[model samples]
Target: MGPIATTFPVLGVAAWSSTGKTTLLVELLPRLRAAGLEVGVIKHAHHDFDIDKPGKDSYRLREAGAAPTLVASARRYALMQETPNQDEPDLVHLLSLMEPHAPDLVIVEGFKQWPIAKLVLYRDDIGDPGILACENVQAVALKGAAPDTLEASIVRLDLDNIDAIAHWILQWCAAFPDHER
Candidate 1:
């Protein structure tokens, strides 16, 4: 079969570590949901991580060589897959996993190198170089005053204004071809 079609809009919140990417999402998600959007999140971890707890049956199953250990409960469900000695799955593959639920938007927390349109977050105090020149960076969210060297055409958003940022994302999603808000 050919590749599955994806209709939902995807946006990445790109930033260096400790730049409040998760914190921004924590604030942004509820606003997006309240505005009647079903949002899915895809977070990329740079190191090994585990959602399953040790001694849990699901964890034991995974450790016992189950390719994907799925545990379901009345409230929610989780699927954990083992990829020992394997390369990390690319963004497309990961996004495909979200297709069944059909979220209105997918907010990616990392994958900064991917070509998806992203809002670059920065903290001037960290002194990390800006990623405005990177591919598909449509806007920048600054924690402090706008850097003097930033390009004038790039959209700048106040890092603390959750409402405005949420509004901007909603507008952007609506602008997507065949996208209905």
Candidate 2:
């Protein structure tokens, strides 16, 4: 019972609320891209969010009962599906949808409780805590140093060092082969 096993390389950026998880990913993504890696991101929203506007045709069609509404343009497309029944969205299913795109790495933001191999971001000034998902946390990003009580097995990372974090992620992606599991 290690971290959640996946066929493709997946790394989760997990953190408590208001821990700047998205901000770190925003900065980390371009570095990964500059290293010539194709990356896919799946972000979980705890609050309700709306992608489509009120008067758009896609919105109208979706309101008229399209379960999965896909709008494709020449360059890009978006698929919106409504799930009112599920307690929690399935991370595996989301990963499957992105599998066909063949990204070199998939970074999952949020969904920290899903038992995936993840780097936990913690700010000592945030004051809530210094940890999340103890069993699955492979690394931890902190503003300063790791707490003395933290396990030696967990890699301590400097949150301000974007280059170092990018290097670590690249190394992680290399661990997974370019074939399916």
Candidate 3:
């Protein structure tokens, strides 16, 4: 199948561990739903993972060296394949391969280096100084003053205020409709 064309822009959540990024996402997702926009989530894992049970048919096929395994049902399906480890897939490639079911916007987690527009999440406790390291970061959901470079472009937000954060995101999305998937 050809790549799925996006109706809205793709967005990413970039933040250090324990900085409330996931918590904020949990809240933010529902608000987006209320606004009538389709949403999808993509999470990156640094380690390998198996989504199948060890003794299941699909898992057994994979363990027995099947190159590819597909598990399907009426509601959902998954395909797993073995591939050589590459440094990392680029944003476009990853999107192409994994984004067919993506909604109006695909919300990504843990891809700070990709050039896609991003919302940087930060807190004083995590002590991560790399929140501002990427060029395409459009906003920051932060607890306090962000790095000086982000002052002008960043929208300072208290992670606890789901309403404010959602409003800010809505405004940003309105201003940049082209960014939507």
Candidate 4:
């Protein structure tokens, strides 16, 4: 697929470890939903995790050499796939899978290595915390003062103001349905 993300905008929330990325997302998701937009979230996990417990049928099945064990219910479902010897998950593939759902926006958390339009959150309390030089960072949200070294081109946002942040993201989605390079 040639530049698949160009067809639909994928916004990313990037921050250093313990920078409250999840806390922001948890609050922001509802606001986005209240604004009458369907949002999809893709979170990148750094550690190994298992949603199903050992005694659970799905977990037992997966442990019994099943490559993927899908657990479903009337309300929700989860698909667990094992990738032995795999180093990293292919984000593009995940995007392709979610494309059918046709969400108004897709917000990605973590996966800082990708060249996507992202809002980087920062806190001055973190030891030597500074803005990362991610190529596609559209905005730098800060709890305190924006670093003097920050470029004038990048928009500065208030990290503690969820409504303002949400509004900025909403405007960004409207301006660039297909964003960044």
- TM-score for each of the candidates: 0.92, 0.91, 0.83, 0.91
- Candidate 4 Cα lDDT to native: 0.82
Model 4: per-residue Cα lDDT at residue 144: 85
Question: Scored by CA lDDT, what does every candidate get?
Answer: 0.85, 0.83, 0.73, 0.82
Please give the TM-score that candidate 2 achieves against the real structure. Answer: 0.91
TM-score of 4: 0.91
Candidate 4 lDDT over residue span 50-130, tens digit each:
788989888889999887777899999888999878797778877776788887788989878777788999887763544
Which residue pairs in model 3 clash with each other? 6-181, 7-181, 8-180, 8-181, 9-179, 9-180, 9-181
Tens digits of per-residue lDDT, candidate 1, 47-152, equal 8999999999988888888888889999999988777776765788888999999899999899887878889898887646656566777788888877787788
Per-residue error for 109 in candidate 3, Å, reads: 0.4
For residues 1-181, what per-residue lDDT tens digits would candidate 2 score against the true structure? 2455555788889877787988999999999999888889999998788899999999999999998999999999999999888888898789889878988888999886776778888887774554643557878888755567778888889898889999998887787866432
Candidate that scores best on lDDT: 1
lDDT: worst 10-residue window of model 3: 1-10
* RMSD versus native structure for model 3: 3.8
Which residue pairs overlap in candidate 1's backbone? none
- How do the residues 116-136 of candidate 3 rate in per-residue lDDT, one tens digit apiece? 778888776676666666667
Over all chains combined, what TM-score does candidate 3 have?
Answer: 0.83
- Model 2 ranges with Cα > 4 A deviation: 1-5, 130-133, 177-181
Alpha carbon lDDT of residue 105, candidate 2? 83
